[model samples]
Target: MQHAKLKRSLTVFPIVLFGLAYMAPTTVFSTYGVVAQITKGMVPAAYIIALMGMLFTAYSYGQMVKAYPVAGSAYTYTQKAFNSHIGFVVGWVILLDYLFLPMINGLLVSIYLNAYFPSVPFSIWLFAFLALITIVNVIGVKIAANVNVLLIACQFLIIIIFAFLSIKGLLHGMGSGTLFMSSPFVNGDIPISLVLAGSSILCLSFLGFDSVTTFSEETINPKKNIPKAIFLVALIGGGLFVLISYLSHLVYPNFQSFKDPDSAALEIAVYIGGNLFQSVFLAGYITGGLASGLASHASVSRLLYAMGRDGVLPKNIFGYIHPKFRTPTYNIILVSIFTLSALFVDLVTASSFINFGALVAFTFVNLSVISHYFIREKQRDGINTIKYLVLPLIGAGFTIWLWTNLDSKALFLGLGWLAIGMIMLLSITKMFRKQPPELSIDHAEVNEMQA
Candidate 1:
């Protein structure tokens, strides 16, 4: 029996919304205190640097999605642009995000729930969170997108509230006593190197912008809208991160003084809006976590299906789409199971693991652009030179810079995962004697569907 394909009902609006949801725009608060400390009270500055770097990579992603409008994200781009062996490794490395990200969301939410309800078991909260996203994804990505719309809207509403209260506090001479302050960007004697390090960690904030490409198959007009959505998602999401971090900085200038860096946002909420607003703020933070889990859960399932359909993984299980739902049923279930490991891991370690793969994927995607456009297609004309080579080269440079700045532990873990993937590649291709299995991505057929 033939497997049902992913349903094509998504427009660019929902696609961008899904990316924002995955990125969790409200996450600025969740990560604010940690990044604030890392950058020496320069979280906003770090975010600006991260946004610039991510925009370069986002440009490369837009270019790639235009060329290959399909389900696989960095995996498909790297495979088609270069050799299958290298692509398999890139896909495997990026697969770390697919495997661990959902769990990170789960772990984050469970912690919040456990805090709110001291009597409940963490496992219960985690299981319920996993079940909700899994069932939503299983029903359909359209439903997931719709759910994201609501969850993401809540996140934005909370942000607006926070911004309002922050502005009020600034007017009344609270923390910084001024809305416009340069202290968030520059402080006494803090090295630029620390802000760069903070930006490396903050790169995780822009994680899902490229993910919209994974929905190319489901999106209407994959080539046209997918590229547009990618740029829009990255720009909008990054802007939000920078803006929110700046506001939070202005509201509470002393980043180093939080009782618990992990729960610093809560303290800020209490400072600005008191306990009632604090409760509402916590609810919104949890909403953001749920939104990220739902979006990431849907994204990784499709990525797994892409790898599975390519026969790099067990095709029978991972590639099999649900007949009626037109979703990657098995892959969705598999992701939920892997997310169970969140119960065992800490948030910091889990977050570090994702950034390693994300930065590497960014680096390779930029390289893929050069390989596909500059070298393979010989698009060496005047403007094509800049479009194909220079821009992506800058993108690669930015990612490599971020890669080197990755936490030492994450670097070690990522390399270990890559080594294991290479070993698996050797086994799959009989010691590199043959090309690994590849997907038959039919752009022509997709265009026909578009027409």
Candidate 2:
């Protein structure tokens, strides 16, 4: 009997919306103070830099997804572009994020909830939120997408209100007393190095765009929609990040004045409106958490399903999709189980691993585009040179620069985690004597696809 395949129920819009939710649009507020401080109130400029970097890499992801429209994402692309062993390693490396990102989401939301309902145990908040996320994912992708759309809408609503109030406050002489200010995007006094530093930090905000590629199997016309969705998600997410930070800089020109850089958004909320707005802001934050958790939970589960279906991981548990629900049930549960680690793990430690795997995946995906198209196919004629080689080269350069700029703590921990993945890869391939199992696509779908 053939294995139950992932159902195709998505299009460009839903996946694009899901990617926005995964990026957690409201998160710009949370980190506003820190970024402003880093860039000397040039958060908008930093976001622009970050957006450019993501766009270059986003172009590469778009290209590769067109060639190989499968759920494996970076791992599949690298493997096919190169070899199974390298692909196995990339997939294993990506597991750092795919496995724990859901945990981070659950933990953060639980932290916020625990603060509101201090009487309730942190574990209780974690479990309740995780349960909701798990149940939604287990049900189906369409249902999960619908839930995220609601949550994403709520976040955007909060952001819109905050922006309107900030503008109102500016008109009434609350901040710089003027609307247009170039200082946020460029300051003669602030060094470019600091702006670049801030951009590196903001790049994390662009993380979820690539996660969209994991849904290729579920997307209608994977070749068309998947590539379109990847670029759109990155552009929308980056644009939102830039706009929010710019407006915020105008409203609160003094980045150094906040007592707590961490909760700076709360101060901005209360300043623009009042305690009422702050309360509304907190409620909206819950929606951000919900959106991020639901999206990440769904994405990681799909990655696991892809690897499991390929027999690189245990096929029975990770590969099996439900016949009725058409979801990867066991992998969903496993991701939820991994989320339990949130209770004990701190944010810093968990985040370190994610950046490493995320960067490696980004770097290799760019290389995969070049490896598959430029070198492998020798598509150097005319437009193919720019399409195959130049764009991905720029993309790879940006990711490599971003990799170099990783915080020492992140670099240390990321390299350590990568070492572990290498060891695992060696054992899986028996010391390079054999190839890792190749990813098997649903050929029925591939045959239907046009060349």
For each candidate, how many residue pairs have backbone atoms clashing (under 3 Å)?
Answer: 0, 0
Alpha carbon deviation, residue 406, candidate 1 (Å) = 1.1
Question: What Cα-based lDDT does every candidate model obtain?
Answer: 0.81, 0.78
Question: Model 1: residues >4 Å from true position, as ranges?
Answer: 1-18, 114-145, 214-225, 294-345, 439-451
lDDT of 1 by residue, 153-174 (tens): 8888998998899899989999
Taking every candidate in turn, the Cα RMSD to the unseen true structure, in Å, is 4.9, 5.3
User: What are the runs in model 2 whose C-alpha is more than 4 Å off?
Assistant: 1-15, 110-145, 211-225, 294-352, 438-451
Per-residue lDDT of 132 in model 2: 94
Q: List the residue pairs that clash in candidate 2.
A: none
TM-scores of all models? 0.83, 0.80
- Residue-level lDDT for 315 in candidate 1: 88
Error of 2 at 77 (Å): 0.9
lDDT per residue (tens digit) for residues 100-147 in model 2? 778877776776566556699989989999889888888864444466
Q: How many backbone overlaps does candidate 1 show?
A: 0
